[model samples]
Target: MSAPERIPPRSVTSAELLAEGELTVRGRIRDASNAALFCTVAHAGQEASCVYKPVAGERPLWDFPDGTLAGREVAAYEVSEATGWGLVPPTVLRDGPYGEGMCQLWIEATQDAELLALVDEEEPGPGWKAIGFAEVGQGRTALLVHADDERLRRMAVLDAVINNADRKGGHLLPAPDGRLYGIDHGVTFNAENKLRTLLWGWAGEPLPPEAVGVLKGLRDALGEGGSLALRLAALITPAEVAATRARVEALLASGRHPEPNGEWPAIPWPPV
Candidate 1:
């Protein structure tokens, strides 16, 4: 078995970071979604890379309107703590020309023994592929079959709180270190919207006993009585916040395990 993975914490302050990296105003990675550049820094005479996403200019994509990426990142860091899944590590958000920008946690590579076997360069799909294991005949049919269920459930609750409407298959990555990390949290905390890609494959089903306990822990940690509730209400609408709290309460009260909902589609976009 692989040892548990850990996301290294951040200690560098904003001023220290600004002083370290050269201002290489990059725009090559720019597409419709976002515009980004890397902060190139030297450590012991070695160059290290980290990405910085600047706010979009006028006539920007509505997906990240008003430069909410920085706020969303801050919120994600906080909610990730509430989930206890440890999927999101520390990240940095800084000021930019038009709006707030962000310094994100960079992923070095994808490392999964099972996924490597399924790789086929000929038809490596649209997203990142696992090429190293294609020669070896080893892969699993389903994603995260061996994942810690309790941890997944905790993550689900965190998604609920954040209103993460886009938990797509690609967003979940299995690291070489045997840990799961969730990325792309720009579409969260709208209050009225909670569209999802995964987790609700089985909706309206009772959560497992162990999952229930974890939710209980999450709720207790997030807040009790009306204190935490008020805080969330301020960020999200009253009705939406209440509904979320109720869902948590319902999970804690029920004993049945989760089941397939068989109603909603995987992605909100129309099938191509």
Candidate 2:
């Protein structure tokens, strides 16, 4: 028999990550019900670790239709990248172990000790912001905290725009290079106003000029036949895309941080 060709793994550019390739499942994240897997992808000699969530494995949600979560994750990444905040890791939709799904660059979080120290604190230290105090367990009080860093704040703005239904504290990742990454965005961009998050600290505050500029930029990119709007239409419903545009317009029109609607709880269950 003839010998099979073996391609060496190498580095890949951001644009090339989405190219067609075979994804090898290295491990499974058993904790999540959706059968999320850790995969290694080699394209053009470039090797990278990516998280893959196949549509076949996705658990059906009452509010969100089944098999659509994967696309929403990619759409969130699209919005994040378009905002120029870089809040979301590079992601792409591709065939995976189970079926068509989302593949996102894996972000290695900082040490647990550091995260524990911050979580133990009664108030957020410098460069951090306290979301609020809550009875964590059996009357044991704990404070919910988020990075006060501008990048994270930008993510908060994104959550508002996308109407993210899940922004748990643990969803925030502290990268080794010091940049923060927000993940687990499958429950986003609904036509309804469903912004549940832990970033209400900035509620009612005037939007900084820079943040407003980012919003303006996104709004322009989401206009008729705009790249972002067009991309989102493929992932989600057009009405959801219109809702995103409306939210951006609302943010610009208000010129201030958003306040909770008082209907749904502002925070997610298990804040951290």
Candidate 3:
């Protein structure tokens, strides 16, 4: 038997990264309930690696319709881009090995060692904020820490506006270039206020000037006859889009971080 050909990595424009491409499934991501594959995609003779999650691989959720998680993921990227925060990597919905799904640029972690250390400390290091405590294991309580970086702060604001339902620790990625990105937004944009996350350290604090600016841009972009609403409508229900607009309005009206008030837990399971 002959060995399969290796797909050489090639640089491509961001547009190409999210456009139609030749997808080759590589492997699976562990611990994910839905099917996620590591894949290399080729477009215009340029190759890029990304994470692919097909709709057909989605597990049914009581709150969301079947085969909708992948769309939700793309919807999240749309929101992120509309805000001009660029917190989410380029993501697109397209057909893949298992059927139609979302494909997002893969982000490699940069500050893993530093972040790992911070998580282990109850009083996390300076420039870090310990929001809450989680019982990790062995009767030890690990502090849920978030970086004091501006990008991360903007991400928190973005989550509030989008009503991100799950912002696990692992979803916050610091790239080698010092850029931070957020991923795994399959559970976002719900009609209900389902913003569960470990980013409560900024709760009650006034929204920073940059954060407020981003929200304003997002608000304008989501207005009637705006592009954001149109883009989101294709991926999620109108109710979800309305809820997103409402959340943005609420955030702008409050002018500060929100306090957890929902019946659901403020943090995600397996917090890390």
In model 2, the runs with Cα more than 4 Å from the true position are 1-11, 112-128, 138-140
Clashes of each: 3, 2, 0
Q: Flag regions of model 3 displaced more than 4 Å.
A: 1-12, 111-113, 116-125, 136-142
CA lDDT of each prediction against the hidden true structure: 0.51, 0.83, 0.83
- Tens-place lDDT per residue, model 3, 1-272, is 99999997666776476567788988999778899999998877678889999988888889666339889889989988887778999999988778889999988887644543337765868788767876767998777677676777888888887788899888988888877899999998889888898888788899998888888888888888889999998999888888898888898899999989968789987667
| TM-score (C-alpha, index-matched) for candidate 3 | 0.89
Q: Write the per-residue lDDT of candidate 2 for residues 1-272, one digit (tens) a residue.
A: 98898866666675466545568899999877587999887777667788998888888898876338888999999999898888898888887668788888888988652332236766677766777777767877767666566766787899999899998867888888988889999999988888999887778889999999999999999999999999998898988999999999999999998999898888998776
Taking all chains together, the TM-score of candidate 2 against the true structure is 0.88
RMSD of each: 10.7, 4.8, 6.3
lDDT score for candidate 2 against the true structure: 0.83
TM-score of each: 0.59, 0.88, 0.89
Give the 10-residue window scoring lowest on summed lDDT in candidate 1.
128-137
What ranking emerges by TM-score with the best candidate at the front?
Answer: 3, 2, 1
Q: After superposition, how far is residue 122 of candidate 2 from its true place, in Å?
A: 8.8
| Residue 164 in model 2: lDDT | 96
Error of 2 at 263 (Å): 0.9
Q: What is the lDDT of residue 94 in candidate 3?
A: 88
Colliding pairs, model 1: 202-259, 202-260, 202-261
Per-residue error for 4 in candidate 2, Å, reads 28
